[model samples]
Target: MRKNEYTKNYDITIVGGGLAGKLMLAVLINCGVFDQDKLCWINTDNENFKDVRVSFINYKNFIKLKKRIQLDVYSKDYSVIEKIELHNTNEKYPLKLKDLNNHGIIIRNDILKQNIKFSEKKIDIYRSKVISTKCDEFNRYLFLKDGTKIKSALVISADGSLSPLRELCKIKYLNNNLNHTIITGYLECKNFNNSTAKQIFLKDNFIGLLPLNDEKNLINFVWSIDNKILDTNKINFHEKIIQMLNKFFLKNNLIFDSPKSKDDKFKRVQTYPINVKFVNIPFKERIILIGDAAHTIHPLAGQGFNLSIEDCFDMVKCLKNAKIIGKDFGTLSLLKTYNNIRKTRKNFITLATTLIFYVFSKKNNQLNNIINYGIEKIEKTSLKEIFKFLAKGY
Candidate 1:
């Protein structure tokens, strides 16, 4: 048996250093829960992140974070989205989402990672992998690969979809691959303003173009198509997509100017298999899962990241209350409250998005017409409610 050569203790240990994890750390630091030295963050590697990954934060969620955390340090650098335009294959008129108060802000993941400069001074960040975990009645312990161990009163797992700590807890869950492929990349565009987030629904695929910065010269594009159409040869896929988009824009009388070139390059075209996953219960013993670790949903509604943001805020609230009441912050009562609040919203969002995919994916002409008509009616009559739901995530 090995002796404990190095042992450290913290009030809270955060596993995973993704956006959600960082937001939690920032909140803890801002809320004055514990000094930076009293908290620990265990991450495998901080340098292995993509600068291209992005998310759209609803106005309400943005305000919430900005008011609580020091988000202004980096959030103001992104593009503010004022409108959302949705298109269908059969119609020339698009469904427009423009709310004066409930808009979205486009932000890059890299910027968010960099904005945490303020918190770097306080938290004990370990750049090592968690080899295993051990827990007792009162505290939880993490074993790192470098033969170091750390203990904490509460452990938060924001470790993305494939969380090792979640596995160690033996938490039963449901995971299903939808057999769809999502191709995401950045593209240069002309005749586009940075005020709108657009999604065009075609017969076989859905394309989302989000403004990356204020100039709107570059767009972050995500295309969700059938998995079978993915070609590994990389043969003129970029050209074909540009041509198709220009044609669609012309049909809709939208300005889509492209410079005629003999060779055009696409940056970082990556494919991911779409999946729906969530745990049955979010906590085991002293550990609680949040963000993607607890639930993941389809991108059809662009609510995955927003939901994760909300998760952080809600968790902070619950933990603060637990502290105020002088109760063990890691108690089952506190965790159950967090799980109940998140799971209810998660279920509602999952059902809504799944039904939407079903309705839009149907190939029957009559069903398509009916769905389009329904959407148009909703847009005209209840558009504000829709925008509110998307913005506030109720």
Candidate 2:
């Protein structure tokens, strides 16, 4: 069958309608670049409108979101975080986010999606998968699974880490698989408040509890142990999680009321390898990549969404400038400018997070001493300012 053709082509076609794609649409439309008729968005995931994963928005990024999209309505279901607490299982020292002057916000993915849905002025969203994409000298072709093809001046790939468009474009990436798994779930605690986020670093693992509305909280447990410990056939995952939680609470002398009923209604966990990688070139010819399609970092600092948003910001800025100069938006020169501006910041974040993981993952006495001393110095210094700057997407 001849692929369905678009006689009236769009100026730009974006793949993947996740947070990154949606945000880009908002930025471009709000900037008055293209109305609904000129922008096309292709998304394959149709089961749910948003992802369940949560993201923490720092002050700086929050401002950008407000300016780029309608945020007042989205803030209704989100939680504002005033402090973050970090503890070492074997040590007495703990760090708190109150040391930092500014606070962050914890938002569910659904809220973000809803906000975008409300803010989008005139953008076409296609609920179909992109099977293949090719670029020639003049126009880029995107072939959808449903026998439709779109020819546009530029194509943006925000599909994510294992992007089909990036693969089709033959882009190379550097991958670092940490061989670790993070298990996350929601817990109902009687005494857990919504004002603080907590992280407990243990000998072989770490636990992060982020408070949501009411008495509910989200728990992210990251274990660096061998994957064999998770027995799929016989072991009860919830019981194991509860046991670990109790052990940590007991060890730290923290108090919390037991569940009203133990029916396992709030028990769910997913285990996946932590991988980080970056594309050598984020753009080529009439094709460009953003968000996880361009790079993915460890989730330790919860900066993945922030980085993706920043990517959209930079790309939109570059495109706006290109338009002013009457230059092609997808040219290598424009993309190189965007890449050069973002690569240094991305490298710095990747290295910093990796260093933190390495230092905390070790159990040697000398390293522990060094970490302890470092923590003491950080507690006394203005490191939170530096951290806030990075977290706020400086």
Candidate 3:
């Protein structure tokens, strides 16, 4: 038992083995605060991680990290999203936001995992569940289901939305339930261009077509269904998509039958209600929450994953600063620095998505006029660069 105790102790312990947690581990490795024995990862072994969902990666931020810290996130496997075209009902002008640097990439979850996992092989990995946690002033202790206790000076929770570590810290969130159900699935289309993604605003909800590959045939689709329009449990995705698009999008692109072989990944579908939340402060005592544990946003912008990456990088920055001063990085005072930065970013992103969602959902003449003015301002003025920065994280 003494040997077990010695093996389990660490300077930092990170929970949640998802992309956020792994990214945190990778950045911390780059920060050079702790070596192999001092840092550890606790994976939620219960999850097989259904990786059908795709994410919008801000390549500028990723490439910055890749260049500075040697992350392998940029490669030929990703599909570039050079432009985003937004459309609405009744002769609406598509709001076009262009990135001159081509800073956005739409990549599935699994490939992204491969890109970030290269440097994490040196750390101690625990494939167990954290059942309970206790903390003193200098260190937090995690009791795992696998009969081990981990003592760490700092605990970073990159766990999922329902983070057990956040609950233990007693952090509260600002909540907004959009009351819309989103259906995500792959669509096989004829001559689907992977360079430009499109969003169509219908009378009720919006549809997002995110490019998936260079072949230009497969696209990841996010269709939000207003609760009043249909039951979430009873969605027949392909038929409903055909019905939804034939009215507004027929001439723009053609969607064909998705490949439905058992091995065909495109046939998988995931449905979840849209809810947005943000923590006022995502840190307490010696623990900090990053990624989905810290905030949730409307998926229209596809900024959630990129925001998570920003969170991890910022947390590492705080830790590195604290280390340079020979101070405890786990202290609540030091963590407040990270808290302020991420909260501001989280607020700005959440509010932007909320505005876009509101303008589309409300569908009033006033809101329509407001969006039109905003889009025109973006196109005609230098605000276009700022808009691109906000959308693509340049």
RMSD of 2: 3.0
**Which regions of candidate 2 are displaced past 4 Å?**
1-7, 47-50, 74-76, 99-101, 118-122, 215-228, 231-235, 251-266, 383-386
Clashes of each: 1, 1, 0
TM-score of each: 0.90, 0.89, 0.91
Task: Please tell me which model should have the higher TM-score, number 1 or number 3.
Answer: 3
lDDT of model number 3: 0.78
Task: Report each candidate's C-alpha RMSD, comma-separated, in the order given.
Answer: 3.1, 3.0, 2.6
Q: Pairs clashing in candidate 1?
A: 36-122
Candidate 2 lands at a TM-score of 0.89
Per-residue alpha-carbon lDDT of model 2 for 1-394, expressed as tens digits?
A: 2556553577788898778887787777777765468788886666454455567777677778787764664344667777777777556567766634446777767766667643444666677798887778777988777878788888888998788888888888888876556766555555555767767666656666766554344433433332445443355555665666677677555544323434353344556677777687777778889988888877667777888888888888888898888887667788789889899878777777777677677657777777667777887888756655555567
Check candidate 3 and list the clashing pairs. none
lDDT of 3 by residue, 1-394 (tens): 6525735557789998888898888788876675667888998644555586888778677676666567565556678878888777754467787776775788888777766743656777888888888888779888888877888889999887778878777888877888898888877666667888888788777889887774547778898878888654475788778677666766666645565445556687788877887788788778888888888887888888889988887888788888788887688887888888777778888888888788789878777677777776667888777657677673
What are the lDDT scores of the predictions, listed in order? 0.75, 0.70, 0.78
**Model 1 stretches astray by more than 4 angstroms:** 1-6, 48-50, 73-76, 214-216, 231-235, 253-266
Residue 69 accuracy (lDDT) in model 3: 61
Could you tell me the lDDT of residue 97 within candidate 3? 77
